[model samples]
Target: MFLSGFYGHQAAVVRGPKQPFLMETIRVDPPKKMEVRIKILYTSICHTDLRAWKGENEAQRAYPRILGHEAVGLVESVGEGVTDLKAGDHVIPIFNGECGHCPYCTTKTTNLCQTYRVNPFKSVMENDGKCRFSTKDGEPIFHFLNTSTFTEYSVLDSACVVKIDPNSPLKKTSLLSCGVSTGVGAAWNAANVQAGSSVAIFGLGALGLAASEGARARGASKIIGGDINPGKFDKGKEMGMTHFVNPKDISKPVHQISIGKGGK
Candidate 1:
């Protein structure tokens, strides 16, 4: 019912493939039902954002769009039916949201919500299949993923936001919104990495480094990092990795080496 208070804010907008981002003033609509408005305090650009920025896939392209996902912010306002959070709460926007009562969320097999799975093609709000951002002249701007944080202000489904302890550092906490979480979640949950177990990870970039950190936290005795670039070896060691394997230098695949087949 509250659709009257729209505030003007600046956002980086991309209109075409490989185009420069335009700084445009857009009006962000107040949250609708089960939504929340956030005043972004910190944001991080991820590889996913880079891919979307390139508009790599023609079919997935949506012009005049706001693209971002990893960020930390404060809850500016809560929409109808949002009782768990209030204004001034610290939060991080999650691209993959969980609608607590959904069948998938309730099952032990997975945590993917039935309706809020990450969809590159979904450029609108879940509540009304419409855009919450628009040009000052009223032209609609598309949203990227479920959480768009490339602006000073953003609106997202309440489920997409996780309230955190106000004491947490918003800048560092933003990592949990995407890259760090993706890697750690994979190593901890999907892989079920156990204490004292040996672990091998390929491609030691930010994601791999995060996985190494997770493995280290689990008491992994041997954290072997694999990457074509030797430059990452130093950083990998800093993350508790015990060894580095460059697949290009060896005749055998890194996986085969991990399995005990010696690589040259």
Candidate 2:
């Protein structure tokens, strides 16, 4: 059942690798089954976004794409069979889609559902290999990772959206959609970090800081953060990092300093 309405939205699109983003007006069709139309509220740039823009990942992506994955938005409309969410709901767009029946999804050990593995480079909706966005001149616009958060409005698979607390602050909570959550989950789920153990995390960016917090939560005795720049040390310390290591200052491996022993 088509909602019988079509709309246009503005998006920052990368025409090709290393090219400046072009603001383009795109035609968006109504949501199909198990999809939702989102009115994007806020979106942020991530290192992955930069990598895609630089064509570092071009082999895994197509051109004329809108790049963004961290986003918070409002549900403008829902497609048929979208019962768990509806219009007026606030949500975060997840780059990873979860098909409940997939082996990975059912196992609960990982977020890599096989539904997206068939064509990792294709940015189309999971249910279809086509794009819902088009240039005014009828050119197809490839989505960036399934969640083109750089657009004013976006259509997403219901499996890629998670409804959040209505009263939660949108701007801050948006971090949970990507970077921060990835870091925390890496420490908890991926590493299965043990309590009272040492954790050495490289980089002092948002992810590293979030990992520090996760380590602290797990009762890590010593959390060491390594970065080339000491400017971020204070910020990392505030996030529960017990020590900081500037790799440039140390000729030896930073991990050795944290462990105070030779390689195992």
Candidate 3:
């Protein structure tokens, strides 16, 4: 039985790279096996999304596409053979997919699962080459990454969706699906930032600020943040950045100034 009553809805569509998004009414097919349909509640625009939109990611370009990876939504229905999740479940759609038995997934060393890999350049369901989304006249539109949350409704592989706390605030929780997680993970897991070490983050964006916070949590001796914008300094400092370096103000690289002039 289908819990989702709606079959087609309005979506922001990009016909080509560097093109403005056009609001169009599109159709979403029913979830296939191991797939789930979701009604997007909130989707945060990410820099990665912008990059894809601006045609920076030429290798991953899928025309007439919907680009979004950070989203929080409620499961409207589960497809055949889906047992772990159900209708009405609050969920976050992830770009990464885990098979649970793959070497990368089993080792816990990486989240890049081999079983459910997706070609962001190509727009089709990982299960099959067929597109689940289409124009009102039945013209196929490519799926962005794996979850096209720019649309009002979406269908995704079950492995690409994670159940979240039902009571969690959907607006803030959406950030966890992308940028926030990327920043925190880079600092804690990849960098392995140690206590009492000096940490320097190159930018004052979300990722850099998050890295500073991670370094502070690890008891770093100093956390320096470098950015061109002076307005971001205070917010950076609040997030544990000890010093702010403005590149435009100095003749040389901010690194030379922040880290000191010489080996001495």
Q: Which structure among the candidates has the greatest TM-score?
A: 1
TM-score of 1: 0.92
Model 2, 159-255: lDDT tens digits are: 8889999998988887998788988988898777889888989998999999998888998878888899889988987998887777777667756
TM-score, predicted candidate 2 vs. hidden true structure: 0.91
Count of backbone clashes for each model?
0, 0, 1
**Model 3, runs deviating above 4 Å:** 1-6, 57-59, 250-264
Clashing pairs in 1: none
* TM-score of each candidate structure, all chains considered together: 0.92, 0.91, 0.89
Question: What lDDT would each prediction earn against the true structure?
Answer: 0.88, 0.83, 0.82
- Candidate 3: residue 238 lDDT (0-100): 92
Better of 1 and 2 by TM-score: 1
Question: Residues 1-264, candidate 3, lDDT per residue (tens digit)?
Answer: 355334468889999989999999888888888899998999989887898898886777778898899999999888888999999999999987787777888887447778666556757887887888888788888887788899899999998999999999988999888777887787888888888777778888888887888788888877778788888988987998876677676456546644564211
